[model samples]
Target: MIKALFKKEFIDTIRDKRSVVAALFGALFTPLLFAVMMTFNIEKARSVDDVYIEINNADMAPQIVELLDRESIFHAELPSTGKKFELNGETHTHSKISLTFSDDFESQLSSGLPANILINADYSDQERSSQIRRVKRVLENYEGAVLNMRLVARGISPLVIDVVDLEEQDTSTPGSKSAIILGMLGVFILFSVFVSSTNVAIDCSAGERERNSLELLLMQPVSTFDVVASKTINTGLFGLFAGTLSIALTAVVIPFIPLHKIGMAFNFDLEVAVKMWFIILPLAFFAAAFQLVTTFHAKSFKEAQTYIQYSIMLPLIVPMALEFSKYKHAALDYLPIVAQQQAISKLIRGELTDFTPVIGGMIVTMLFSYGLVLFTSKSLKSEKVVLGL
Candidate 1:
């Protein structure tokens, strides 16, 4: 019966240490690595709230210095051990940025005239750009305060300078915002499906044929369809288990990403996680089926592995490429990897209003898997393939 074939293949796969390691590595290590990179990006992308700037003429503008301190910008002393940087083919140590107030800065302010604060630095250096911007914003605020005092003393409303009223309303939620940067989580989860089943798929197809076991199996009165179905079922389970674990691990990891610091929220609650698991269900089998087909076309385990390693990259690359291009279409919504990505993103953003497309896409994916299953079954009946010629 098909049950005996399935049991035999499943046990063989489980007993292979390589398959177990592939499953654990794909499911366990990937989500953790992704989280670590995301955390690094969060720190890099956010503006520095507290920064250090050097002041050349501290006595000339005490008010400016006070305002800078209030804004968490402090004067920095040059360090004894120099940290160096490279720009425009030049090697340099130290930020070397300083603010020099005009000699008559205090007098100009008292007489209601323009005061100059010259910023001195190598503007070409990219690493110091954020520090420069933060210091400039605080100084600009101090200028606005002085202008307001001037207007009050002259018996004029400070509102006269602001002739146009600019109002801004942000309607973006944290989940929607998180969907922008963290969308790759879905891609990684789907990629795991392709990765986890690779060793098992190769073992069931090319490895068996290479070991002269395929000819023996065909010698039985078993249907080739039964053999193909059992192999697919066995490999698909490994992919599915890995995919499911990927989703759960991603859900656990995303909450600790400091999304709130960047004004983004990702509510990967039980409902959304469950929905994501369901969305990837058909994809698991499709990935396994795809891997098996790729492997079965090759004559040996090494050739199959070479083909499989490249084949697995399609699931990872296609989704991310489409996403980075910011392209969307009504037709692409039913495509396999793209469909899962969109559905998962929508679920994370709490914008998945209709289940019809999700269900339709799932049906389409299963049909594709079945088509591969049929092709693989027919391949087994060939003399050249069975003999690994």
Candidate 2:
């Protein structure tokens, strides 16, 4: 009997063209969009390797020019009008970095006076700003070397000026370093479950009522628990399909994103996919039951859509807020969506060994889902809900 009810609900849901299209689109679009954006950013990062700057008085600082050349910064002739042009089938804009050395720079250095080297660049341009900082560091090194030579000639030890030796050692792994990007990926993965179940939940509830068939189903010999359980199961299956599809697509697309270019290593391998699936599957049930309860309360199909749209924000906003918060409480890992996000993030960073929090959250999520299904079943027996009063 339960199998027949599930089959009936499942067939009806798949036959609805709108629900099928919505499910497929929600499952596929986010991963594809993420891939395209990451690919574009990687290409832009690679383009910074060959930086071209303009030097106004090359003769004044031959040694400095040599330093710039070794640093991969070459002088280029650019238009004085500052107009955009095309190069190699791509539109190009010249960076506004100009170097000008004073004519008496050598004399000033010889006399132990300050030598003037003017760096002109648009500070507002992010790419140009990075190049400008590189240029400034190179010039400072040259100045320090010349000053040390002058100290040696004067019978003074160069170590007289040496004080503190500063060094940097970064211990972040590629996975940990990509926290921001991975956090966003987790959000999209979790959101797919909600999106996949949305149309089906609404259809089985308010949509059935609008079609004037919900009353007929309610009058059947089946218990209210059976009816609600069958609908929730159907919705959950849709959510699970969408969530799994998103993970598969993400695994396929992540490898081609050039994340290594930015020192961000994200491996959506089979193990990670399997872990993510476990983390997200219970959320699918929760999403289905929650949406079922919410939609069952709405007076009409359009009104149900409005309620579900607002409810969707809770999942997106809550997890993101927890992921980015400065003050993280350890108890957050025991919460539903928050726990799942943290687990996925740790999995991405390869730091997750203990599954206690994840399992705990899944159990809590399932219990909550069961409670919502019971509430929805009880609502089905109410006259106001059945008659849309």
Candidate 3:
């Protein structure tokens, strides 16, 4: 009998265009958007390799120009009027960086006097800022070499000027460095579970009430527990479908992201995908039960939607806030969304070994889900909820 009710609800939800569209949108849109954005950012980072700048007096500092060339920065000619310039027959907008060397630059350097080299660029432009910094660094290197040569020529020990040597050792792995991005990805994955079942939960509860069919269904021989359990199971099945699709799509998309270009690595292997799907499974049930409890209280479909929309903020915000917080409470590992996020994050970083937290979280999540299911079943017995009074 419960199976028949579950099949009915599932078929009705499948036939609803709004529900199907909502589910597909939740499953596909976010992963595609993340892939496109990451690809664009990585390509932009790669474009910084060949930086072209204008040199007003290239002959005055051939050595500096050679240094710039070695650093992959080359000279380009620009018109005085417009921002558009051509390189190798390709029209390109040039950066504002223009180098001007004083006529006495070589002479001043030869005499150990200050040589003026002015760098003119738009400092506020983020794309050109790195190139400008690289140019300045190369010029400083040239100046330092000349200064050391002058000191040696004067019979002064160049080592006398050195006070301290600083050495840097970075111990951060690629996975550890990409923690924040992975945390956000985990949030989106969990969010898919909550969002995918929202419309279905509303339609089964409030929409059924609004259509005047809920009371008639309640008058049947089946107990309230059976009815509520059927609806919750249907909704959770839909959430599970959406969550699975999200994980599969994410695994496919993650490899295309050039995280290695930025010194970060996130491997969404088959094992990780399976583990994530496992983590999200209990959350699917929790989401469905939670949504059902909230939606069953609303008098109509629209009211339920409005209420659920606001209520959904808790799931989205809580995990994200915990991810961004500096101080983490150890007890959070046994909570619902927080625990799942932390577990997935540790898994991505190759740091998750103990499954105690995962097991604890799953148990707590399932218990909470069943509690909501019971509350929803009890609510179904009330005349006010049944008749939408």
Which runs of model 3 end up more than 4 angstroms from their true locations?
49-58, 69-99, 119-132, 148-162, 323-328
* Best-first order by lDDT: 3, 2, 1
lDDT of 1 by residue, 1-389 (tens): 88999999999999999988998888887799889988998998885455555687889999889888887776765545665544358544555678889899999989989988998877888978877887788888888998999899999999999988999988877667778777777777878888888999999899998888888999999998889888988998998999889888988898788888888887788988899899999988888888888888898999999999987897778777877989988777888877887788778668899998899889888888899999988987888778877
Colliding residue pairs in candidate 1: 174-265
Instruction: Please report, as a residue range, the 10-residue window in candidate 1 with the lowest summed lDDT.
Output: 78-87
Give one digit per residue, the lDDT tens place, for model 3 in 1-389. 89999999999999999998898888887687778877787788676567778898789889899999999888887667777877789877666689999999889877778889989988988988888899999998987898798889999999988888778999888778777667667777888888888999999999998888888998889899899999999999888999899999999999888888888888788998999889988988888998999899998898999999965675688776776886577777788777787787788777889999998999998988889999989988899889888
C-alpha lDDT of all candidate models, in order? 0.84, 0.85, 0.86
Off by over 4 Å in 1: 46-54, 69-93, 122-130, 320-329
In terms of TM-score, the best-performing candidate is: 1
Off by over 4 Å in 2: 49-55, 65-99, 109-113, 119-132, 145-161, 323-331
Candidate 2, residue 32: CA error in Å? 2.0
Q: Rank candidates by TM-score, best first.
A: 1, 2, 3
Q: For candidate 1, report its TM-score.
A: 0.88
CA shift of 174, model 2, Å: 2.4
lDDT of 2 by residue, 150-229 (tens): 98998999998989877889988777777766777887888888887899999999999999999998888988888889
